[model samples]
Target chain A: MSRRLAAALRPAAAIGCALAAMAIALALLGASPLAVAADLADGAFGNWIAFTDTLARATPLVFCGLAVAVAFHGALWNIGADGQLVVGALAAGALGPALAGAPHTLAIVAIIGAGGLAGALWGGLAGWLRARRNVNEVISTIMLNFIAAQLLSWAVHGPLMEPSGAFPASRKIAAAARLHLYFAPTRLNLAMLFAVALAAVCELGLFRTVPGFELRALGRNRRASAFFGLPIARLTVGAMALSGALAGCGGAVQISAITHRLYETISPGWGYEAIAVALVARLSPLGVVPAALLFGALDNGSQAMQRADGVPAQLVYVVQALVIIVMLAFDAAAGGGWRELLEGGAPDRPDATAETCDA
Target chain B: MLEAFAASTIAMATPLLLAALGELIVERAGVINIGIEGAMLAGAFAGVAVAHATGATLAGVAAAIGGGVAINAIFAFVAVNLAVNQVVAGTAIDLLAAGVTGMLYQRIYGATGRAFTVAPMRPIALGPLARLPLIGRALFDQSALVYLAFALVPAIAWTIGRSRFGLSLRAAGERPEAADALGLGVYRLRWIALLASGALSGLGGAYLTLAYADTFVEGISAGRGYVALAVVIVGRWNAWGVAAASLMFGAAIALQFVLQAAATAIPYQLFLALPYLLTVAVLALMGGQADAPSALGEPYIRA
Candidate 1:
């Protein structure tokens, strides 16, 4: 097979292996894998409403997937995309009620823009820490995710609670700020189109821009990038900010298009799920869409599968985890970029206590 | 209030201390398992399920250890044998554990999401110490797991800081190629460290359901695993430091409970967010990876 075909086939094979593993698991749990699979498919793509819902669900994944791809491409281990998205939604939700009388277009822009900015700051905080303080991004991001979740919980239950104070949710956004559904009675909206456009823009920016080149170079060889006069600190913060903006915008879109109000659980672990999406796409900006859709279909279909086959909807998370594991194993076995993919540049930081040379 | 706070602090610190101690060993052996949270979750679920089924807390604890080890075994195969990126593989492990545990919990307990509780392990009070003043109940009156966790601190400190085996583990982490060249068996050391870490993490998970909480909830590990990761760093990768860091975090968590009960003017969410915020702030202050294992998080394959 041509290298391109082989490359394309690899992820498919990995996904296949993951499904096979899930099949065994399902069978052990006394559920027929085939029936479960059929139910999932019937639920996800069996009808127009289902298909539209899948796309809508995939929207956030697309945004967060891009966020993961951007940051991972720079070798910044950002495990806080979910946190960023939450902060973004919080910002948008907070700003949404105040935009009641504003022009429709302006209100929409303000909501999304606010979310993106909040997300940027949130992500950028970890980035700055990594750049200046030498704090590990992985740990910092995870901590930030917890903090973000608490912040949202506080918002919904306290300041942002609906006026009736009956439910732990924020007030609905103004009609002007809402991204109206394009198809009546369907969840399809302009957010999906915007996401697609952003993906294209991200692909272009990542490949065709000088800054993008610098980021990838930094990811590939951090020491070399530093030695070559690449502004390591600047690139780190910028990539993280951009990544956060993408995820934040995703959150804003969800608020504008779907939920229209804030709640404790704004995201369903989209940030972590995006890791699988980005990895399956091999951190490709353009590939995130399809990858997100695949996972989204599983997510959208899971509830139906649960009802039909006595399976839990969380089974999709198992599929996601398996896909990632299988993909990583396949890639490692195939002699792919395991080192650079994770450790970024040098595997070891210079330890003043002992080791002189690092692997 | 002081005595209650002190006891809560010790109770809260136990799980973090247990997990952090395990991670310290894993990091010392040159592999960082981000999946510690996943292992703990699996342990928590398995402990509750088995104990509920068999009416034996010991059986629950055993099952919890096995659950954690089982999760880590997959991680070991992928991270150690396959030489995959440890962080991503660990993340996958976390997700898998969450998915598996959540699914099984739902399947067995029904989809209504009712609370499930088991008989909690009884506390064993030390003879004279239990009857003493402020620190007595906090220090001497606790479940076997609490005492074991604190006891492991010095034991782990001595084992890693002084033992010949610790030397080999450090060698593997510092420079795997060099360690391999010296016949230290880097892969073997890493595998052993990961499995040991898994068991400790599992035990920590069991402590949650069997001793402290007496109930199992999905994601009950609740970022405690991550906090333990931070504890290793803040503890400066030593057992004593880990113990200290865990106590500080435990105090923060305990304080939250106390403050929440008082129903103060302050928002409860602030209290809930305290420990996580502390993790970030402490990590920022700790700054730099100067004390970290040289080959930590690096994939090492045998030649």
Candidate 2:
């Protein structure tokens, strides 16, 4: 078979394997594999609302996925996206009242920008520590996630507490700050377009720009990148900030377009799940779209499964986790990228095209 | 009030100390499992489920250890044998734990969430010592797990510091290939270290469900495992240091509880964030001084 065809067929085959595995697990748990599979499909794609829900879910995943993709490309791990997303929402929510009298378009832009800034700062904090103090990114980011969660809780319950003090959430965001919805009653909005546009921009910048070159070089080898005159510290921090900006944008868009209010808990582990999304996409900006959609389908279908099939919605996490394990293990074992996985067993292939290094 | 705070400090620190000790052992043997969070979660669920079903606290604790070891076995296979990326494998295990635990919890309880509780392990008093003045009950009156954890701190310190086996453990962590050449059996040592870590972490998880929280909730471990990682770092890879750091963190968390009870206008969330913020602050302050195992996180594959 031709390389492209084999590559295209690879993910489908891998996904099939994952599904079969999940089915066996389900069967052991006393649930019928066929019924759950049918339930998942019907829930994710059966109706217009479900389809819209999948797209809406995919929107945040795309932004967050890109966030991970960009950072991983630079060899930085932004595991704190959950925290960044929360901070983004916090920024946007805090700005809602101040923007109450502003023009609609300006208010929307400001809110989104604020969210991105908050996330950038949160993400940049980890980058700064890594570059300056040589602290590991993984532990730092995880700590930051905890801090962010507390901060969000405080914001909702204390400073931004609803006027009546009844709920741990902010007042509804100014109507003017809300994104224009494309589908009536469906949470879908122009944010989806923005997410895709930003992804396209990332794709171009990563492959076509000097800064992107620096980032990818750093990811490939820190010593080599520094040897080649890259401002290792600045690039490390900058790449982290940029990655965080995307995650912040996700938070901004979600608050502005969907929930329309900031609650105590803004995300259900979207930041961590985005790691799986980015990896499954091989950290490619373009690939993130389809990969995010797959995760999106799982999430959306999970809700359906819970409601109809009596399965817990968290089964989605199981599936995503499985995919991450298999994908990473596959990458490590084969010493190649997504294409290699799809190409069956091409051991001798150069790693030039592989998305993420084992490091 | 002071005694309550002191007692609570020990209670809160018990889990962190236990898990941090385990992680310190694993790191000393050249493996880093970020999935410590998942292992704790599995233990928590297993502990609660078994305790609830059998009405035996001891059985629940034992099951928790079994559950943790079983989960870590997967980590051992992928991270040790397959030699995959440790972070990815660890992360996958965490996600798997989250999913499977949630599914199991839901399967038992049904669609709508319901409470699952177990009788807490009764505290064991050091008879005469428990009656001492200020530090009496806080130190002498505690559960079996707390005593076990603190006792193991010294024991581990001795094992990893003075014993001949300790030399092999450090050798495995610092330079695995050399250790292998010396017939130190690097892989076997690493595997054993991980199993020990898993059992300790399982005990920590059991403490959360059966000793302190006395309940099962999704994500109940609540990043304690990660905090344990930070504790390991802040402790500078020493058993005594780990104990000190864990207690300091425990105090910080215990104060949060106190502050929340005080009902101050200060965003109570700020109080909640104290431990995490302290972790970052400690990392920043420790910088470079907090050395780690040289070969930590590298997957060992036989050539």
Candidate 3:
């Protein structure tokens, strides 16, 4: 078989192996493997409502996934995306009510900008630390996530909290600021369209722009990029900040479109899950679209599986873990031959080695 | 007031010290095991489950080590062998552990609706040492884990600084290629370091369920693992440094609780956030010249 074909088949084989292993384990536990698969299908895409739910759920993943993908493409790891999302959502929640009497279009724009700017600022802090001080991004970002969570908790329960003193959540956003549902009888909103547009813009910026080339170059090798006169330090921080902004936008979308208010635990670690999504997509901005959807389907369906097949929703977490493991295993076994194909059969690959470093 | 604060601080610092020390060892050997959180979680669950099942705290401790080793083994294979991204692999392990433990807890105990409680490990007082003023009670009047954590600092310091094995481990982390050239098995040393870390981290987890909280709630580690990671950074990869950093963090955490109890005008959540905020500020001021092992976080593979 041709090398490219073999490369394409590797992931499929790994998935087959993973599923077979899971099936055997389930069977040993006295659960029908076939029944579980059928239930998963029924729960995720069994009906229009289910499909819409999956789409709605996938919305945040798409934003976060794209965020991670953009940063990963630049060879930066932005582990603080979760914290950025939280801060973004908080900004949107705080701003939404204050802009209640404003024109609908202006309020909506302000909310989105507030979320994106808040996320960017949060991300920018990490970037500044990394660029100016050479601090490890991973450790700093993770630490920031804790601070952000505590900050959010403090806000929701203290200053920004609803005066009624019910749950740990902010007052609801104004109707003018909320994103309208794109379709009737479903929670899917125009934010999905925005996500799609942003993903496309990221793709263009990564592959078509001169600055994108520089970012990709820096991602591939800091030394080489510096030699080529690319502002390596600046790019690293910028990539992370941009990545965080995307995640922050996702938080805003969740609050403005779905929840219509900021609540404690707005994300079930969507920022962290974005890492899995980005990795599974091989850190490609365009690839994140489908990868995020797959995660979305699993997440939306997990509850159904719990209710119907007596499986825990945590099973989705297991599946995600499995996907990352299998994907990495397949990617490693296939070698750079697959990566070359992933890079569109480019023989003179500039970023292949750096990409491997990223993985 | 001072006495109470000192006592609680010792209790809180024990787990962070144990976990941070474990992480320090692993990092010194050139591997960043982000799976400490997963290891701790597994230890917590296994420790509690075994304690409840066998009614022996000793067996629970043993089971916790075994569980931690099993989890680390998965990380070792994927990260060490497959050359996967260490951070991503570690994150996956964390998710996997969280998911599996949550499911198992539900499957085993969800039906009963009764809280699973075990006999807490009894504090071992050091007779004469326990009678001394504030220092004696805080240091001597504690469970075995607290004493072990304190002793571990000097023991680890001696091991890493003075022993031939420490030299070899340091050599491996500093330059795995050179270590390999010198006929030292880099992979084996790293593997051993990870397993040792697993044991200590597991003990830390057990401390949570068996000593600190005495019950298994979701996310019982409560970002302590991340704090441990920062402790390694702030400690600058030294055993004594880790101990000092852990105590600092522990004190910060304890002060939060004390302040919350005092119910001052300042919101309790602000106090809760103080440690993390301090960590970030310290890191920023310290300016990231951490001097981490050269090969730290990079998987070494034999060509």
The better-scoring model by TM-score among 1 and 2 is 1
Tell how far residue B239 is off in model 3, in angstroms: 0.8
Whole-model Cα lDDT of every candidate shown, in order? 0.90, 0.84, 0.80
Cα TM-score per model: 0.97, 0.94, 0.94
Which of candidates 2 and 3 is the stronger one according to lDDT?
A: 2
Write candidate 3's Cα lDDT for B1-303 as tens digits.
Answer: 777788889998888898899888888887787788888998898898899889999999998888788888888888777766676678778877887777777776773325978999998999999988877778888999998899999999999989998988999888888998888888888888888888998999999998877778877887788778889888988998899998888898889878988878888778877888877887788875446776777667677
Q: Rank candidates, lDDT, best first.
A: 1, 2, 3
Please provide, for model 2 over A1-359, each residue's C-alpha lDDT reduced to its tens digit, 9 standing for 90 to 100: 87556554555665666777899988988889889888888888888888888999998899999998898777676777888888888899899767888899899999999999999999998989887876777788889989988988888888788899999999889889999887787777899889889989999999999999888877766655656667878997998888888898899889999988888778989998998898777788998999989889888888878787787888888888888777766565555453222222111111222133222
Model 2 chain A: ten consecutive residues of lowest lDDT: A345-354
* DockQ category of candidate 2: acceptable
DockQ of each: 0.73, 0.45, 0.44
| Number of backbone-clashing residue pairs for each candidate, in the order shown | 0, 0, 0
Candidate 2's DockQ: 0.45
The digit string of per-residue lDDT tens for model 1 on B1-303 reads 989999999999999999999999999998888999999999989998999999999999999999989998899999989988788889999999999999998988988668878999999999999978999999999999999999999999999999999999999988999999999998888889888998999999999999988988889999999999999998998999999999999999999989988978889889989999998998788788889988888888788
lDDT tens readout by residue for model 1, A181-259: 9797889999988998999999999899999999998888776676677888899999999999999999999999999
Q: Candidate 2 has which clashing residue pairs, if any?
A: none
lDDT of 3 by residue, A1-359 (tens): 99878765654565566667767756775678888877877888999888988888888898999887877666566778899999999899999888878898998889988999999988888888777766667777888888889889988998899989888989999999999887768887788888989989999998899888887776655655656667766887788888889988988888889998888889898988887787666776777888788788878877777787776677666666777777776776666842322222111112222354444
